[model samples]
Target: MCRLALKTANEPFSPYEVLQAMEAMKEGYDGSGLGLLLRGMEFEDFKYNPRFPILSGIAHSRKAEQRMDEYMDDRGYELKYDHRFAMNPEKMSGKMRYRYFLRAYRMPPAFKDRPQEEREEEMLRTRLDLRRIGEENNGDLTVFSFYPDVAMIKEVGWPMEIGEALCLWDGQIKSRVCMAQGRQNTNYGINLYACHPFFIQGIATMTNGENTAFVPIRDWLLGKNIPGYIGYQSDSEVFAHILHYTLRQLKLPLQAYKHIITPLSSRELETHPQGDFLRGLREVCRRLIIDGPNAVIGTLPDETCMLVMDQKKMRPATVGGRDGAWAIASELCGVDAMVPDRDPAFDFQPMREHTVIIPPDRKELQIWSQHDQLPLPQAA
Candidate 1:
């Protein structure tokens, strides 16, 4: 599958740009489906109610919609604003057989003043509950994300076809950061949940390769007993959960994620300053280690965008952009299409042992290597 991630320092941008880039790089992939994950929302309701969770999903019928409304009311979630897509009727059948809705809901009275962790946990539980209800009723409802300032859209169709059907180019749905994936349709068959750009809480990621170690990782995460980690519809979904577990649950540093998923060799670790600590992690997180050819591009709760590749470096990824905007993709041509006019010399592929990070500041981009003492920061 092809993936494109874009982040801008100033102004909200359209998801169309994301699909455009993916379309430009559509060669090997069949584009069986498209998934769009957006953050840093530019909608008016989001601007006014930034703290309220925005539920983005689909409902198969009016009965399902009524069930959702009643459930939310009983759970004490106050609806603040609602935005439903005017779906093109022709595309609303078969795999795309549902109505998409983006509703912003205020936290329940009990959670309004609760700790951030508690509030977030409740939100996740609510989403899971809704998902369970949907499954019990023959997939009547499918909630992708229930977090503030984040929205996701997944439909089985060509990038532009789905875009036009959803009326994404209308410009009402815009964000400062967007990660879009054009599915290549592999072993898993074509399912919406199996699409890339999977999200949980505030962590969203889209990968370009298969996870050979998916079962082990999924088992380990399920062992954690976190409801948000329940969905394994896509092997790559584990990547986002692993990130959330490491950063939010374990309270580990951002760089720790790179070491956990793609641990360095013993000899290489020995020369690193955090070698001792990393060695300990290698054993503890052994089950979490990925054994596949994958390139991951993700965004953190803090809007920090990052790209890292598997040890095998089988999947290609490139990062390039100018002062106020940046883009990462599976191909250089996609990057060129997203952020053109920048000096090509500055656009370099991240090495197998490296991680490219761009914090929300957007002032500079940092390149951190497993063997290096510090990340080399370059002017944005």
Candidate 2:
């Protein structure tokens, strides 16, 4: 007959603890009894959330096989038994018991892919490249947390509330900067968080000279000693300090440019101090176009394009819009919206992909155009 005893304890058993317990039980018994002890234990008794049950069972199984091996070595016995509790002492020997236990508790298969150390080294190299790019571009860049599309926040688990709070606060700071800079003339706006499969847009701007920069106003607020829930809230003031230091180092032409950096919540806008700032920014944009004609509107590449096509008036068949229109929006979306429908032949392709018209002289009506095409390098 099989004898099973379930231990009741408030504290859960770890895998090591379970292995120790099994070892203690094996001290008195030979191979004949050790296998029975293992098979008889009610695995359900050790079950607990997270860790206890699964690991303990694994430990118990390993301990049983080890004890059987020790018994076989000492006694030089071969063990035999029926499927149930029929242990014939004459037919069953220690050697047979060891073999039986070995078969029952085989080790799991090994992983086939690259070693973890190699994978980690690869990841480290990639991160280094990212850091170098950011540094070369004057610390202007966006970092995003990427996840699979099928993965839900609740199902996969994430700190959604905390993330939203930080994003909203960031947005507020950006909107304020946009308002102060004059949106219409400066072409400043916020960028949406890059959450899609494509590249992240509107994090930082790479200047014509290849130097990178972010919105100054948002960087300034991040440097203030303020109570907030963002991850870097404690070092907010440091962020601003870094921005100033970087700008000074780069010797950028800040006086000629206005920029804003707003954060969008998923697809929609979030409410916060930043939201109010964006409202003020919109008002500024409305006023600038109404009053100023020669003002140089500067915006991030994407926003500049968006504003030109969506909000400004443009001449028919013109590849580029007037100063005010292109100042705010300078992307394909902006350019497409500005051009009149009468010229079906006039199509606006990507500035980088196609040739741009360069006027030879202020008097000459004919424009010189050339396409500088370069093939994309093969990915490594």
Candidate 3:
């Protein structure tokens, strides 16, 4: 199982802190890779350029570097900021080298003033197209994400070394929300894109256990006419796509996702207070059911984050935070690292079959039981 730690606050928050938490619990993962996604991002220069899409990834060679610049320009994305990372070479010498670059781009002129939703859809498709090009061109480029207010930083190394190499140990990036995952998967290749904290169209998720139902989930998602669904490098990526489908495509409520992915059982539904509606949903969307002992933590486009445990709660997750900040991690130790001196009254671990909704500021924590959610009463 991998380890995940998330920190979100009302004010500017640094993801470097989350990396520090992962470092404290480094013993759990081999540290083959690390993935970080930050929303409501903060950087000295990026502060003034809030509307541009921040594209961050690796350029494997000089040719790849030239291609990236050309692709962005030819596509009408004005390159506003291009910053290469400064790695601590002393710490990374002799290690497999991956060059990191962050480029902020103004949307193509045609996209300006379009409805917010349409612009988001356009940028998302563009990002996916760029990633596909990278894949087809032999991995010369890896475009992480192209969205406003979100920035991605990923690397292959032990948590501590990766943090140090990127100077995260001293906190160089800040955001209202940030998540870091110590990728430890026994079943997959060590691909960087396969790392946790998977993202698509503003929805992101990272899990801490195996997804036994991954095959069926991926098969179903691939059938959907969605562009961003192509990169299922990690089985867990479906969790993020399924979320996008449910909330964006189908236009369902947030809680409805819990039912679709981990719906109530037939036996339980028969007696469930929300029986009638639950039965209908199960009949229509049973393929979305996820069978697992996994714990999933994710963030919504609205800046709300969620922590959910499978009925078994086989994987561990803890909750902690103070008035302005909130955190959820595979272990409480990580949470403790975020809000070191928290109010004891606000700290607690969620039980099995539970879901916790934490806002961007993490000002309040809401818990819902899977089997206990009563469907809306049917009208006459």
lDDT per residue (tens digit) for residues 1-380 in model 2: 11111111122221122112223333222222111011111222222121110111111234443543453334322222111212233432211121111111111122114464443233223323333343355433222211110000000001122123223122111110010010111122222111111111111111111001223333443455322211221111122222232233322222111211211222222333234433443343221111111111112211221111111122111233332211111223322332222242433422211212222121111121111111212320
Q: Model 3 compared with the native: what TM-score?
A: 0.94
In angstroms, the error of model 2 at 70 is: 45
Off by over 4 Å in 2: 1-218, 221-380
Cα deviation of 73, candidate 2, in Å: 45
Q: Per-residue lDDT tens digits of candidate 1, residues 191-291?
A: 77888788888998888888989998999999988778887888888999989988887677677788889999999988887677778878999999998
Candidate 1 residue spans exceeding 4 A from truth: 44-47, 90-96, 373-380
* lDDT assessment of candidate 1: 0.82
- Candidate 2: C-alpha lDDT: 0.21
Per-candidate TM equals 0.94, 0.16, 0.94
Clash number by candidate, in order: 0, 21, 1
Q: Supply candidate 3's per-residue lDDT for 292.
A: 77
TM-score of 1: 0.94
Give the 10-residue window scoring lowest on summed lDDT in candidate 1.
371-380
| 1-380 per-residue lDDT for model 3 (tens digits) | 88999988888766678888997788778867789988886775545376887887787878787877787888888888776555787776336455687677889899888888988888887777778778888987888888887888777777777767777654456788888899886778888898888888888998888888999889988887777887777888888888888788977766777888887778988887778887887778788888877888898876898888777778888888777888888887898898787875777777765678886556678787766764343440
